[model samples]
Target: MTIAYDWLALGAAACWAVTGLISAPQSRHLGAFAFTRWRMGLVFLALAPVAWLSGGLQQLSLVQLGILVLSGLVGIFIGDTALFASMNRLGPRRTGVLFATHAFFSAVLGFLFLDERMGAQALVGGVLIVAGVMTAIAWGARKDESHAFESLQGHWPTGVALGLLAALCQAGGSFIAKPVMAAGVDPMAAMVVRVGVTCLAHLLLLWSGVGLARAQGTMTPRVLGLVLLSGAIGMGLGMSLILLALRHGEVGMVGILSSVSPVLVLPLLWLTMGRAPARGAWWGAAMTVGGTVLVLLRSHS
Candidate 1:
């Protein structure tokens, strides 16, 4: 708890950034539904080992199990579903930027449930994040014609609606996770339950609605491998780290730090794709960093 929550949050953000960038290449070959399914499935497969290794499973209680599953359904299942949909609807750049909105939701959630006070730094940081998004995304563009970010504001209604949904689901998922674990659940065990439940949620969605199943791109062995990468990097390690950090720290800080994904992905996009982000991306980075720095300085007060 003594360490800055923002640090762990940043780690989560950076990890997620890498996860998205890594997943993007392979994701191109797969449809969003199929891609997300495999990605989440891999997470469930890996959770068994992680849970056992962490020794969190030994004492897994009913309440803990319940909370974990709920976390999965809400956080991984619903939150990520919305997230990936956003990626399809809006590309990674804009999605990442909009996804940063999770900070506001987390802040509100923290205030309500965790009784965590938002310092002046947190407030100012939140405003800066908004400013950054507005500055960067007001007219952001994506190279990928199919990606939603290309015309996000042009179809302002759809993009804003989906982003808000993703933000809410993620925020709710984060809010529910802490108290459950803090009530004495081990973080690793909690993750296993969440991932497993999330997997089921996807499965159920696929079955319940033909539209979801039909939405998928063809799933072949090659595509499956990429999904595995997504699970390993994006869900398994990244999510586990998030659970650990949230268990030990406040969600507000996590939210603030998590906002870094938009900024973190820029360099990677440039390096890997030989493409610089739209000018809006750079401005977003500055504001996100500035807001994050506000958290750092204020946490000292």
Candidate 2:
């Protein structure tokens, strides 16, 4: 079961990596906020039918619905806001490095709230995983761009604070959803509720003239296709896999595995961009894999 969770988490990571590729240009064309709004709306539309068809929606109690909604608000809404803010302040490379702290935050919060304990091997593995991710983000950026170091010129303290808060909120949101998933709620049903809440929240923001109140450009076929692809991979499939992982494995471990998106994205980028990944990127991938093996091995032992 735990192994299944690990694989599911990896699948989720792959989905997110695909989303990044599809959405980056699309978001550039449509503006970030507007793209996100459309993406969330698409995810809701995609998941709602699945939930209904699978009878997952009918099995949820009111309490479970509430948990999922809250999780969505915190994880999707608030967490995303903080993440973007941090990115604005620190830029992508620094922000990516900071965002990797989410796994550590998830683990520590799980221990504090759920009393989940890890063995020494798991601890070492977790640290290595984080270190590898950070190294990859920081070093890969240096190799990939001449202007990468320029992104570090912002208010470091504020960015760091918001980044950490985002991490905590993300982990907390996942932790809150675990008990309901453990209680036999279908991951798809939970996903419907979660995505529904985020969609509603985004709509409210738009309605109130708070954020992404209008479309950035006329929706073209290319933009529409990219949006659909990104939403399907990142939110529809990626989020469902995450919920399934949380159902079958500890949230902390799942978080760590899912955080491997940076490592996973390397080959895809190389293939698409017609460039080999930096040596640092390869090292990062190797370390991430080694660490994951250690964590899984120790957990089962």
Candidate 3:
């Protein structure tokens, strides 16, 4: 049933929420590029066996494999690194809200490239989603907020720019993979290709002797554990769900559902940080969800 992909999309959202909660400290500890590289390596190691055992690698043509590699480069490598960089500067909650713009990007890209129709209702939903993201970023922080998770790192504008870049890359990567997924590629196999290529790319970057690409902190056993867990849930489970959903669902609808990570992360942040989100956070999350629902309704109609 179509509802099945909806559940998959929601599941991916939940997974990403948990991932963000776990990843904040790790991102801070390792720096964005290093953290993403480590995370991708762990995910690739864990998934390679499963994909090989399932014979999913045999399902792809060279062209499909090439697309998956590009997806990994854009989505996992660049998008993920930008995401964690934004997270390091802006914290998880704010980054999540900004990253929610990917839903709007996905919808528009779907219309332009996938022959997906965007009616008036969907257009309105897209506007609301963008407005909600801007509203949340502008007022999401409280003056009295003293938690590490709420503190700003580097430049706020830079963080915002990185978050938007991550969103665009996320949508672009998914759009690139949609056709391949629709062609009956195995989700696990596709993940292996994507993650493997990404992991290799990270290795090459690290080996290139770029100071910015090097690890910012010493790797501890605790940090390693956190990275592994984050990668397992975030990339291993979360991304596989996206691929599966893409196999059967439209890009816009799947992106809208998965973008609920911003809402889900609020409670997780509250639980971890021992305080509720700022008032603007709740309002922005509400508008985003409302927009998502509107879009879904239009899709069904």
Give per-model CA RMSD: 3.1, 2.9, 2.1
The whole-model C-alpha lDDT of candidate 3 against the native structure comes to 0.86
Query: Would you list the C-alpha lDDT of every candidate in the order shown?
Result: 0.71, 0.76, 0.86
TM-score of each candidate structure, all chains considered together: 0.86, 0.88, 0.92
lDDT by residue (1-301, candidate 3, tens digit) is: 6667877988999999999989999999889989998998988888899888888998689999999999989988999999999999999878987898898889888878788865788678756756665566556667898889888999999999999999999998999999999998999999999999988988898899888789999999999999999999999999999999999888987887788787777777778777777898778777877776676566455
Model 2: CA > 4 A from native:
81-95, 142-165, 299-301
Deviation in Å, model 1, residue 28 alpha carbon? 5.5
In model 3, the Cα lDDT at residue 125 comes to 74
**Per-residue error (Å), model 1, residue 109:** 1.5
In terms of lDDT, model 1 sits at: 0.71
Instruction: Using TM-score, give the best candidate's number.
Output: 3
lDDT tens digits, residue span 169-246, model 1: 887898888887556676667877877777776678788875854444567787677678767776766776677778
Ranking by TM-score: 3, 2, 1
Model 2 misses residue 154 by how many Å?
Answer: 9.4
Model 3: CA > 4 A from native: 119-138, 289-301
Ranked by TM-score, the better of candidates 1 and 3 is 3
